[model samples]
Target: MSTLSYETELDKLLKGSNISHDLPVSQLVERALERKEGILTSTGALRATTGKYTGRSPQDKYIVEETSIKEKINWGSVNQPISKEVFENLYKKVLAYLETKDEVFVSKNFAGADIGYRLPIRVVNEYAWHNLFARQLFIRPNAEELLTHEAEFTVISAPGFKADPNLDGTKSETFIIVSFEKRTVLIGGTEYAGEIKKSIFSIMNYILPERNVLSMHCSANVGDEGDVALFFGLSGTGKTTLSADPSRHLIGDDEHGWSHTGVFNIEGGCYAKCINLTEEKEPEIFNAIRFGSVLENVMLDENRTPDYNDTTLTENTRAAYPIELIPNCVIPSVAGHPNTIIFLTADAFGVLPPISKLTKEQAMYHFLSGYTSKLAGTERGVTSPEATFSTCFGAPFLPLPAYRYAEMLGEKINQHDVQVFLVNTGWSGGQYGVGKRMNLTYTRAMVQAALLGELHSVETVVDSIFGLHIPTRCPGVPDEVLQPKETWEDKEAYDNKAKELASKFQENFMKFDKVSDIIRNAGPKF
Candidate 1:
């Protein structure tokens, strides 16, 4: 209602609480407004409180920092005509933001001839950083020229994006900057500044002169006997919690890339689920948030902290906190190739409880399945057991071709000889509303077995309905819970529920039937 600068609005946003308790808004604002004069001649050149390297190799000296408009502020309320010229005319502002800084790293990318900015840590917010590494903003770049350009990092902005293809065809409101050396990124959209945190860990790890690593989408950490189990799943699966095991040493969670040498984390922070989360249920994750955590758009309490009990705002709650909060967070987020790669599913029918040992065909089947329930308030309102397809794990946010990455994965599994398993983190024995969620503790134990290489040896029965191989005994889980059962308060109700879920899976998979016969058979066998 009153005239206010973008700084003023940023002040309010900074002071506001995210789902995570503390977000250094003032610190972020101050840095965002800093000067950008000096040139960075060093190998790597970005410096936040923790500082980072932006070079591909030891000798490379990329642009340290750049500038842009602070678009998150609501200019209409302030009577400022919405500025769409930001993408083209924000160099002065970028310099002003860089004026206060000593050394920083920035990257730029060109797709064909389309140029994009990879803003320094200052201009990009924590939330934006999250989506960047999630590969949500992967653009089709001019690979030939990109290789020629000295500045391999650049940021971009695409406004008014609605994740729909038909109605809002070619319409999206997303801005992101990607890094080549660190292979990290920062992403944001109009409604939200940054929805997910990616590239923070691997970027930080890249700077450190320790383990040579690269960021990935698979979750891996040190487990029993120093064996690390890598958990790979589509969204809504329990990759974060299952990998955040207190009993094991956590390397990193979510988004890992592997090579002949080692594995690395692509995120600077952790983007964790906050819907109905409690300290008692996930102490490792609960404790990870404190000083460096940035809570994203969650309803706060009088104390300006997350009210986990309160669900009035939005259930798509998320927290962005530094990985250092995890007990044994390793810098340069790298580890030996995963001993096990587990595919996770949140089967709403409650019929799939923690299955394991997916054959290569089954792996490709579920890989293309990309199943997960949509958030209640987000896009299409809460619907019944929705089956979405993402090429590898994420289809919306990737820079490289989906099949290229998938081929890489298939090769890695063969080369490194990594074992793969499938686990459902959602409801079991009953549907979502009707059945209780399987204990996170049980899921953790089953994952531990997979990582420890115990589940790989003893698997036998083929599940009648899903056609998945069921392991007889998964160290921590009882034998009976291996297969999903149609158990409901009413027998007819169970039949109807299973039928409904089956139908949904069938329809979603029908389109991909040409991809493979296994995936063609992904629908409920009955």
Candidate 2:
């Protein structure tokens, strides 16, 4: 069948009473409980388990090779390409499977917070809980907007539909296929709801850049003076924790777009990590988990209260809640262009400065580098912390060339005179097992100094290896703590470890073929 044939048929399947259209959170949660799709925790948040798959199946993800995006996509292991026939076959299977269900859920929403740039989206899920995940994660349209809504892109997720790899042309029974030409994302076999959220982000990563908007994988907030700040980091890097400042109004916890006018959140809600969660550590997130929020894979004790520390299911436990649930969240989730940018890294090696100012070139360099560390015991055969570098801070979601996003960021930084910094939230004094982690109080103090412009004119000393400008003094932090080597018991060991990490940076940068000499020179020096 032709693409139009399937598109025309989808409209008919979605309009009947068998489709629960635009259900509220209460109705969705009720349906989910009645259907036994999930259970309600003591806090009133619904908890659902993603049966075989607890995380994203990146290897099985694909983008259809169509004439429109044929020459544009960075096509590789990250953005794999499949044929139109394969996508059509799998998409048909999913829709037909949904037809067999007692009922399906649908939601009409927007993606970008900026009205001008917002992309109208429709999500159709075989599970009620998944639809709730969509409604909470995406920008929910008002009643007036929904009456006139027409989705430019559609996501059809039927986790019950399992593909036949041989006949279905899939890497596995689980597959996430995005057909830009068809304006649809077809997910099957995997029960993971995060796939639904990320698939849309991957699509936005493609669509927004074409409009000259730089889509970013970062958390944002605005100070009292309306000075905006951006925090870029991967999971476990404290991006969410740092951006949840009691003093600053949070713009969004993850995924934002920078257009000519200013910064806007791409998501209507925040999906926070729930492992090791505590009210004392993240009070806002703890309080936000009431009534309408959705929790994934979090264990519950006999009293039906969530055990945030339990990881029997997976370490990637998450909770999705509306942005407004956060008391200090910006109403429209919009802000002026960022005045400050912080690249957060948990450098376990304990060599980088606690906090340091960055030059434009260095910012671009580090932005592209996107460095972090994976601690030992987190994975098998890992006896020590390992270096991790994801380009543009979000390599998995970037469908376009890495340099495309990097160039856009550089242009924006130059145009707005943005100040960027690298803050290490990892171990200090020595590598992971040897030293204590950087104090959260001190980390917050250093970040506050940067946001308040306290580090702007303070006396600075340049690091010999990485060329980062370290602030000599910071409020609420001892002077020695600001210097990594000064706190270390053995100074020579610090130099050796610093050099070791510098080599890893050089090795990772060799993959980029388009970086310029100036930005290239901004990395660590031997």
Candidate 3:
């Protein structure tokens, strides 16, 4: 039997339209520049602006409620359900729109680094830069793999195609709908490149857990001795920054799956926050922006050098670069079971301790709570640090119940005897306005101590409200700063803030009624 060709599969979607299949990175970059899709910055990075939609439009995203996976889905405000009829109509429309186009670019890649569980994906993009974006973001297939490649899932992205809300049964012109039964993702109306990356993540989140693998939205790195550490956090909590440690080998910056054998990265690249990026602070990420990297929504000066401090377009400015660009990244992006799991939180309220040890039950509680502040401009219309609770650190991408993931994490922690720590990279001394952000050096030192097991014998003091075992004697951090209450001039005010935050935690936990009582009881008590 003859092997299926990439062009043949792409032709089925093209409907006789011109197709550009698996173009080399150089050609893709040349085509993107010729099309005026983006400009080459002085640093040799391609800076592209996602018109109208600088960030993800979660409200416009949907999943087809087909019979096969309908009941399995945790249908809610996040996983909004659309009818099969609606999906069919939109899918047909998207195909027709593509057929009318003069040309389209296609790239074939895999989503997981572990070959056994990897998902073969073919991304069809109407824009050249988007093809480059997909190439950099997803794991590229080698010549041998490409020859036999059959896309298990396909993403048809046409940012120029807008939807009619009334006619299409959509919320707005922008739509990102996933059809598990069809094994296809249809993205239209928004040009945000992250939509492509996250669509695959959502699919993995749904499929991996059923296979007994725990898929996570976190960052992972391994020490010199091969001890692995996982960092779980939402935007602005330093998951990317802290995980890119020079001394350690970076397994991946985001999206990983932990199976029985070990942990593997889901992405081939890093989508790092570029706002206020500097070579002095993050040399690896800053330097990784040269050639082949795609800078999204970042401002460039007359000299075409990126203005990292500029947020005029959006604070959610990002750079997408392949893992190899980072000097110390681990190839194949897989590592052994993690010895330490860190839950990073940017507590705008500033009453939480800088770092604390977590009991298994507490780990489950915080995992479900997924508390963090939503930094400005990460999403459309978001302008300030708003208290947000995303179950499992990435609720938007999750299709199953929050408890399902928390249950998997609990089992993994026990099975591996993994030490869990909750590190607050947010505010201290006072709330957001009055308090300063936690010092990065102190946070790094605390994390280092945890990774090296230096905190095992350290003295701890319990926070009465939150019940976290705050370490009193971290090596490099000041004694006073370890305790949130002591760092504040007004202790009474700190007490009030702690209770308020504790009450918020309880309120959030109320939504997860199906969680175990042990986990519920482990939460903060006012």
Candidate 4:
């Protein structure tokens, strides 16, 4: 299909009476129920199951091989390539399948919150709930902004349209193909709404960097005195939990860009994990789930109330809501250059320090390392903690080479003179099975101490293995807990465990051969 052919078909679909453009939340919820797409929970959140595919189908994701971006992308297993023809065929198929639907949902909005850097985006969905998901997850344009909005990137998602792996060059029935030349994303065969959200993130990760903005997968917040902080970590590392402090105004929960002027949110809403969510533990996120919010794969009780602790469907259960729902959220989701950067890690090995200040070299090393751990029983795997390192804390969404983003971060840190800290929220005395998880109260205290400058210029002791500058004591935390080695019951056992974990760090950092010697020496000494 030529550009004109697809444009004509898409224009016909958009101009039809069956197309619903920017329908209010109430009507979309009504349409979803009428179509039996999902059920409304007692809290009025629309609960939708994603069938067998409850999470992202990374194996089926691809980037079209266009000449312009061929040399730019980090082409490997992480970024699989498909010919341009395959993308065009799939794009046509998705659009054609959407035309056959009784109604299609369209949403036009922006990605970045900063007016100068924002990317105008449009989302076309085959399901009403999906449109609502897009509405709740992406930026919602005001009436004035909508008047002149022209989408720079358009996403077309048709979950009912499955690809033929053999015929369509897809790995499976699912496909998430992005064509950089077309500025279009085509997603199919996955009812999981996160695909719709992350697809645009992938686009921003590519586009923003070219515009001299550093795109990041992190949560940000602003303090009372106007200090901005960034929390970087992979899933289950308490990035969301720590960033949503009632004392601080949230800038955004995920996806942001650091432009020449300052930092700005790339999303208008938050997609929070709802598994085991409780009001006492996370009142902000819990209360945010309301009439317009979309709840994915969450089980309901007999009274139609959400079972936050239930994981029968999936532990990846989530809540999607606009940023306005959070009482302490910054309206524009913009902040100044970060005064502090915290790299969070759930180190199940229990070897990393609880709170350790980082040098610029160490910060760059750990930022690129992006280390975290996967606890046992989290997936279908064996019962043990597995070390997981995602470069820059977000490997899957980054479209460019890892070095591109790392170099950008190094420059930003140097220019801003940002203070960086590595905080371990996973384990303390021993490894996962033996040692318990870090105390939430103590973790909060340590984070607060760092944010408030309580630990700056404080007494410190360097770790023998990891070489992290650990604070001697924190305000509300126990003195012994400050040193992980002191809390261990067996002295010799702790040494062996620490050495094993240190060696893992050394091995993982080996992939970055091009990294400067100063940054390389910042890793574990073992």
Better of 1 and 3 by lDDT: 3
Give TM per candidate.
Answer: 0.64, 0.96, 0.97, 0.96
lDDT of 4 by residue, 352-450 (tens): 889999999999999989998854432333246678888998888899988989999999999999999999999999888899889878999999999
**Candidate No. with top lDDT:** 3
- Report the CA-based lDDT of candidate 4 relative to the real structure: 0.88
The residue ranges of model 3 lying beyond 4 angstroms of the native Cα positions read 1-11, 15-17
Runs of candidate 2 exceeding 4 Å displacement = 374-386
- List RMSD in Å for every model shown: 13.0, 2.1, 2.8, 1.8
- lDDT values, one for every candidate: 0.48, 0.90, 0.91, 0.88
The 10-residue segment of model 1 with minimum total lDDT is 52-61
lDDT for predicted candidate 3 compared with the true structure: 0.91
Q: Regarding TM-score, does 1 or 4 come out ahead?
A: 4
> Model 3 Cα displacement at 280 (Å)?
0.9
> If candidate 2 were superposed on the true structure by all CA atoms, what would the RMSD be?
2.1
Q: What stretches of model 4 exceed 4 Å from their correct place?
A: 374-385
What would the per-residue lDDT of candidate 1 be over residues 1-526, giving only the tens digit for each residue? 1224433543443244331211233333233334321111111111111111110110111111222323221122111222223322232233233333343322222211012112223222232232222222222123474455442333322212212313222123232333332232423233332322332322322322112222235677775565657776655577777878777776666666455555655544466666677889888777765543444345554545566566454554555565666787665455566666777777766766476677666666666566655434322233344555554555433433334455556667767777777788877767777777777877877877776667767857876566777788777777767656533556566666666766666776665534656446544677
Residue-level lDDT of model 2, residues 1-526, one tens digit each, is 8767988778878876689999999999999999999999999999999876877777888999999899999999889999999998887778778887899999998999999899999999999999999999999998899999999999999988889988999988989999998899999998888788888999999989999999999999998899999999866677778888898999999899999999999999988888889999788888899888999989999999999999888777889999989878997889899989999898989999999999999999899999988543222234456788978888878999989999999999999999999999999989988998899889999999999999999999999999999999999999999999998999999999999999999999998767889989999998
